[model samples]
Structures are given as C-alpha cells and as structure tokens.
Target: MTSADRSSDLSRAGRLRLAVAQLNPVLGDVTGNLELARRARAEAAGQGADLVLFSELFLSGYPPEDLVLKPAFVAACREALDTLAGETADGGPGVLVGLPWREGDKLHNAVALLDAGRVVGVRFKVDLPNYGEFDEKRVFQPGPLPGPLGFRGLRLGVPVCEDSWNDEVCECLAETGAEILLVPNGSPFHAGKPEVRLQVMVQRVVETDLPLVYCNQVGGQDELVFDGASFALQADRSLAFQMGEFCEEIAVSDWRRDGETWICESGPRVALPDTDSARWQACVLGFRDYVEKNRFPGVVLGLSGGIDSAVVAAMAVDALGAERVHCVMLPYRYTSDESLADAQGCVDALGLRYDIVSIAPAVEGFTECLGPLFAGTHAGVTEENLQSRARGTILMAISNKFGAMVATTGNKSEMSVGYATLYGDMNGGFNPIKDLYKTQVYRLAAWRNANRPEALKGPDGIVIPENIITKVPTAELRENQTDQDSLPEYDVLDDILECLVENEMSVGEIEARGHDRELIHRIEHLLYIAEYKRRQSAPGVKITRKNFGRDRRYPITNRFRDRS
Candidate 1:
C-alpha cells in the first residue's frame, strides 16, 4: 500500500471530528476562564467533535504581564488545567490547550495534550519572541523542540504558538513521524499579519509536506487583541480550510490521505478583511469588548462635534448600542452656538443619550482656586489646559456615578504630540480611535456613516453629522481656539506624526521632506515632553504598525535628541 493509504488506515476507524474553540478570556481569571473552556468543550462534543482545541493561553489569558511573576497565579493555572483535564476522563473527546506551567523553579509557556482525562504529553514553547508588543523572554523559559506523542497508535506533534515560526519544531516532529501538526497561538493583530502566517505555513508544508492547522486566539486583552483567523493547508502547500478573522468559530474538516500526502476535505476558504476595513472593525470590536467584558454599563465622552470626538462617539455607539453611549457637551465661555448645535445634531442623528453639561462652574472653581497665584498673570495655554482639565473632571464624575467607561476621543495626530490634555481630555478607560490619524478618522467616519455594517452596534443612518465633518477643529478651551492655533493643519500634522512616530525619522530628515525645520523641532519637543502623559494614558485599540502602548517604548525621562 502507498504512504497515503497507510496514513488513511490510522483514522479509518470512524470520522475524526475536530473542533476549534475561539475564546475571549480575562487575564488572571483562572476559575472563570476554565469554566468558559468547559462550556466550549461540552458544546463542541455535543456537536460530535472527537477533539476540541482551544486558543493559546486560554487558561489565564495572554500577556498576563506582571501577573505571571506571581507564583500564586501560576499555581492557579496548574489547578485550572488539572480540573479541566479530569473532566475529559469520562470518555469525552481529547483536548489541546495552552497555559502557563511551573516546573520546579522555571516558568514555561506550555500546551497540554489531554485524552482520557489525563495530560498525555506537554510541549513547551521553543521560540520566545521579545520584539514589539511581546516580552516573553522576561517571563518564560524556552524549551527544546518537542517530539511527537503517541495517541491510539497515532503520533501527533503539537507546537505552542511561536514554536512553529521556527523550522526546528516542525523538522523534529516530521523526523519523529508525526501524523499531524497543530499549532495553537495567542498571536495579536497587526495589519496583514494573517498573510504572513499563511506564507510561513506554506513553507513548513512544503518542507514536511504535513497538513497543518493554525488556530489563534481572539478578543481584546488590555492594549492587544488577537484576531482568531484559523486555517489549514494541505501537504501540497495549497489552502484547504480557513476560518473568518476577528470572530469566534468552530469548524470541522476531514483530513484523508492521497498517495503519500494528506489533504483537508472540502471546507470554507474565508477571505480576510482588507487593512483599512479590518483596522476599523478591530477598533470597533476592541471598543465593544473592552466595555462589555469589563461590565462597564456604557461610555461617556466630550462632544466638541469635532471630527475626532464625532468619530469616537459614533464608534462608541457602534460598539455599545445607542442607548448605552452618552455624549456630553461641556461647552465653555468660548464655545460657539454652531458647535453646540452641531454636537446636539450629531448625537440626535446617532440616537445617543446626550446631555448639555456646561463647564463654566467647574472652570470657575479651578480659576478661583488658582486665582491667588494668577493675580496679575496674563491668561495663556496653562489656563486653556485648566479648562480642558475641568471638562475632564466633570466627565469623570459622571462616569463614576454611572459606572461607565470614558472613551477618550483623541486621535493619533493629537496623541503624537502634546496636543492632548493628560488628566483632562485624556481621562478615559479606552480610546477607540487612538491608532487612527486625524485624516483617517474623517475617512472612516464617512465610510461608517455611508455604509453601516450590520456588525456595528450603532444606530443606522448618518451617525456623524455633516456640519461636524466640515467644521474647523477646535478644543474650545479659549475664545477662537482652533486646533490650528496650536498646531499645523490636519493634513500637515498627520504627515509629520507619521514621519516622527511611525517612520522614526530624525528632525532633519523630516524637515528635508519639505516640513519647516522650526515646526519639526517644536513637534519633536512636544512629543518628548508628552511621554509622561502618554505613560499614564489609558489602553486603547492598536490598529497600526506602531501603536503607542506596545510598539513604541521610549523612556519617559529621556534627554536625548536626534538632530540628524
């Protein structure tokens, strides 16, 4: 008989049912998360799956950060995994899961292959990524490439997430005559990361000629969100079965031998969303999940009716329902009637719950408090910041009373420099549009208003009003306080930010790109000084190649300047 026929004989006893469990687990919630795993297993078994595989780090959640440093947390993970292992002993399907494993004095990021209520084998992660957004080396100790483990005469090779990124794991498994390669990942999202996965998988498939299945985790975890886009490739490096991105799904596909090779039976080949659209959707999902999963009742934000807040509010309503989103107009003495009416019109259009909370009293309260020191000083940007802070405090009070998360509406442009107020306008639990630049914010708002995707939870029709779109941007902190009063225009500002933050171009290089040297120096100065504020800022969706939280890690107290 051919190798294909021989491989087929191994699984010909009955249909080998397989299921993928995409879960949204909270960090450090071991008990609750294991229960979620149990429920998912039962559902998969009920659907006739012979083996159910959950995403990586489903036990205690991914990037547990300093929580992993706690011995008690690792102990809790062991207990949770053991409890789940025991549950599978009653003749249910096998389970493959990821968790933190403490072996003596070392902590390993491991995956357990369980069958008949016992963990038959364990594979520790071999590759620990230390670059951008990951600090695995700080927590996990790497292990050697894992060999195959036998189950009912079938040798299975399981790689924990990053293990498959290197060929050592796959070569060892193939050398050991492993029947299949299953990789469980806690991979976070970045534009076009899924395609990179496909490319890597295809290379492995051509080398080992083994049918590979890649399953990744999903949902927002603080600043990171794992888009669970699971897929399988045939031994011939051809796409076999694929799951949708940014969603949770359990799909079963048959694998049979074809003359010394394995091929997945007919299944879905889902197309991943484009970068721009995917980014928009990720922001919306992150916003929605962070609010709902954290048990926050709703969201509140200042509505200057500017493009940033307008887009953020629309995104908030789209994330949480219209009834759950709250818009407050914290108008100051300089606030124009046009802006007031525009804010109201936008809220009304979106069917959101809005209130007019004038910040005059609070602003005066601060002014009175600081009057002694400011007896004869001329009013300036400091006073403007105080006004912004007053509005921020009022929003926080409302949030405190109502148990709602304040969704700060600052865009990438404002966040790039020191345009945002630290304790004032930046007082929020999450920022939906944090990764998007000012120009992209306008484009997305227009796209969302025109084509309201059913997946979006906001009210249908134009959520962001036209007047808000066309109006000049302003903080409304002082009389005639247009954003241009303090910074460059949106188009120019976004380009500069893209260069300084994303491209990491020196001030001289940025100026060489046609921006004025004085402007570049001023922006660079602002950006460096604002590190302290950004350090204490709330976590938000990361939809760019270089998000502030994870991708960029500059010292808050640095005194270096790159002149060239």
Candidate 2:
C-alpha cells in the first residue's frame, strides 16, 4: 500500500474539519515563521481539525521578493519546511503550507501537503502575478500547469493564488479529476480589493465547478498591508464562510461531500466594514505593524492643527496607545492663535502628551547664518520654508533623543504637487496618510470623529475637533497664508490630482471634465517636477490601487508633457 493507504488515522470519511490560519508573519524570519506554523498547527489540532490550511509563503513570509534569489535563504526555507513536515509524525492535523521550494536549479513558489508524518504531495504555482505591487516572475520561475493531488481518498486541486485567477490552471486541474480547490493567497489590501477578490474567486468557482477555499495572510509588510478576509465558497458559487478583516484569527469549518460536490457544513459569516471603516482599520493596522516591527518605542509628529496632522495624530493614537504618541507644536512668528487652540483641543481629546517648542530661535539662527547669501533675495518661499525646516529638525531631534519615530503627515495632493518642502516638514520615518488625497484626508477625519471602530486604540467621539476639519488648511509659515495662496483649493486640487496621478488622464481629457486646460497643464507640470520629492518621501500604507511608491514609478529627468 502507498503511504496514504497505510496511515490508519488518516482517512477521508466524506467529512473533514479544515482550519484556515489567517495570520501575520514577519518576512525573512524563517525561524519565527516556523514557530508560528507550529503554534498554529497545534492550535488547529486542539480544535479537532483534520487539515490546516495556511496562506501563501507562510514559512518564509509572502513576497520574500529578491530574498528568494539568495541560495542560503532558499535553503533555510527548505530546512524549515522539512522540520515542519516532520512534526506531523504526531498524527495531528495535516498541513497545507506554502514555502519557497528549490528544485535542482529552479526555485518556485510552492505549497506542500503534509499528513501522517510525511509530505504526501507538493505542487508549484502555475501563474506568477506580475502586476502592481507584485513581481513574482522577477524572482521565481513559474511552474508548469498542474493537476490534482490525491490526499487520502479525495482528489484535491491546490491552486496557489494567481493560479486560480486564470482559467487554464483550474480548467486543467478539473479536467484531471480534482475534487475541490484550495487557494493560498498573500493578497494585499487596496481600496475595493476585497470585492475584486470575491468576484475573481467566484468566477473561478463557476468555471471549475469545484468548491474553493481561499486563505489569505493578514498583516503590514512595508508599503503593503494584507487583510485576512479568508473565506470558502460552495460549488454553486454561494458563500460558505466569511472571516473578519484586519484581524488575525484561525477559523475552523466542517465540510461534507454531497455526492460529487463538497459543501461547508458550518463556518463563520461576518459583516464586513464599509469602505471608510475598512480604510481606517487598514491604516491603523499598517501603522501599528510598522512601528512595532521596527521596534520603535513610540511615535512623534508635529500637530500643526491642520486636517492632515490631526487625522494622522488620531490614527497614531489608535495604532499605538495614547501614551506612546507624542505631539509637538512648533510655533513661529506667524503661528495663528486659532491653530494653537485647535492643536490643544486635539491633544486633549486623544489624551496624548503634548509640548510646545518655539521655532523662532532656530529660524533666527539660520537667518543669521545665511544673511550674506540672501543679501539680494526677497523673503518669499525660501523664508517660509525655513520655518518648516526648523519644525522638521525639532521633531527629528525628539525622535533621536527619545527613540520614537517621526510621523510625517503630508497628503497625496501635497506630495503630487511640489507643495511640501524636502528635509523640512517632510522629515519622518513614515507617513500614515501619504497615500490618501487631501479630500480623502478630510473625509477620513470626519469618519473618525463620528465612529470609533472596535479595532482601534484611540478614544471615541471627537478625537479630532470639528474646527480642525472646517478651517482652511495652511502651513502657517506666513501671516494669513493658506494652502490656496499658492495652489488651488483642496477640493479642486485633489480632484485634479486624482485625475492626473491615478487616472493618468491627459490635459485635454482633464479639461473635458470642467477644469481649465491651463490649470491642468500647470498641475501636470508640478506632478512631473515633484517626482524627486516623492522618491525621497517616506513609505506609507497603500489604500489606493496606485500609491506613490511601487504603483507609480516616473523618471526624474523627463521633459515630455502631454499637450494632447
């Protein structure tokens, strides 16, 4: 008899209890990831799971990227996989785990099925995704079209992520007698991505006529954030189970075969948050993970009493507790009384530590040092920028002394245009609201004020003062200087920016949308010239399909402008 037949305790009795581990794992830490796998497998065993399914690259962590190219790293992953597979000798739950598998000379994104103290089968991913924020083909070679793996007495189709997204892989598996499809994903979150995943999975189910289980990883990795909204769908394309998003949970479900088809007997079905709620949770989760993973003691940011900083401050309090978020107000000669009051109101609501440091000393010192250099120049943008640089320097000093990360708070609208100063207010380790446009920042601020979700760490009801949102946004560098003094209004600016950055629309196309043509040209020019600033900007969580870092890569020395 084969190993599958010889294992007495391992039998397919037309019913199976499968557990899905929606977990967060740190990349490049194979030892930690292995331990995580061990704990999760043990937990699933305690819950009486027949088999446990983990997300893609659960051992080495997903998107190991260029790390897979290193022979030593690939070897470490293989060793960990073998150790994990050996643990199944306890006759506990079987594990369908993902890892980087190195064969002879080829390395692939692969998953192995383990049971009865041995690896029963191994399958490599067929389709390697190479789109936005994904470049699997760059690091690992693609495997050939695959068939089903016979586990116990049932035939199982295991399609790793992108395999199920295309019809060829699933179609091949189904034609070769696969019973059910289990998809392992390391899918990251973008606005509307959850719905996009559902539609894609539904289409695969419809095409293959097989029940599918999608298990996704949950956590923040650099600029990307994964939401573990794992679920199962029956052959009829009906929802079998729906797990919660932005939280880690090992959910178990019972599945029974109905003639030739399998259906989930029972599993969790939860109400997902709307767009605004999901976006907030994503930001909080991303920010929290970045801080904790990097081992920052806390975070510090300038609370300028503007919507952007207020929103970022509230998010910081939500991600890290109030005790860990430090807000400093750097006042100068042009500082407004209303701004000071608003900043105080925000700190009181969030209940975080607040301090006021005057930038007059730093600014005056710099002016004295540069008096000869600026003998013939007017006190225009340069003088105003000195104020911002002073604040940036002060925040950086606090960060260096207290071991807290500086949280830069610049929205996409400011970054897209050259409105923000480099090494000045743009100084930070990370920006929580970098991907959000100015209008979206206002919207999220309003959302946070009205409702505090259960997942956040901040307090509820008016964490951001209403005046902060209603008032005109400004750098407060000069007397009565507002953002509109140089650029258009935020509402108009954000709309135009979205068209240019996200939509990549031409000047004429933007003008067709009721904006002036010359304005579009000017905005387009600003967007191109600001590429260097964005290149030096801090990374943030990606909420949109095209964020500044990975999604949009433009040349810094380009001269082509779309006059069409």
Q: What's the TM-score of each model vs. the native? A: 0.94, 0.98
Among all windows of 10 consecutive residues in model 1, the one with the lowest summed lDDT is: 1-10
Q: Return the clash pairs for model 2, or none.
A: none
* Predictions in order: lDDT: 0.82, 0.91
Error of 2 at 320 (Å): 1.0
Clashing pairs in 1: 4-260, 89-117, 318-458
> Which candidate leads in TM-score?
2
- Candidate 1 lDDT over 1-564, as tens digits, reads 433443354466534557778677888889989998888889888876667778888898987877888998989998998888888776666788889998888889988877766787888888898988988999999987778876544667787877788788898899888877888888888778889999998888777878888988888887787888888888778888889888877776666656556567766688877776777778888888888778898898888877888888888877778888888988888888998888888888888888998888888888899999999999988888888898889989999998888889888888878788889999989998888889888888777776766577777778888878877888877777688988888898888888988888888888878999888888888888888888888888888778997999998998887666
Where model 2 places Cα greater than 4 Å from the true spot, the runs are 1-12
lDDT of 2 at 271: 79
Q: What is the Å distance of residue 520 in model 1 from its true position?
A: 3.0
Q: What's model 1's lDDT at 482? A: 85
| Top-lDDT structure, candidate number | 2
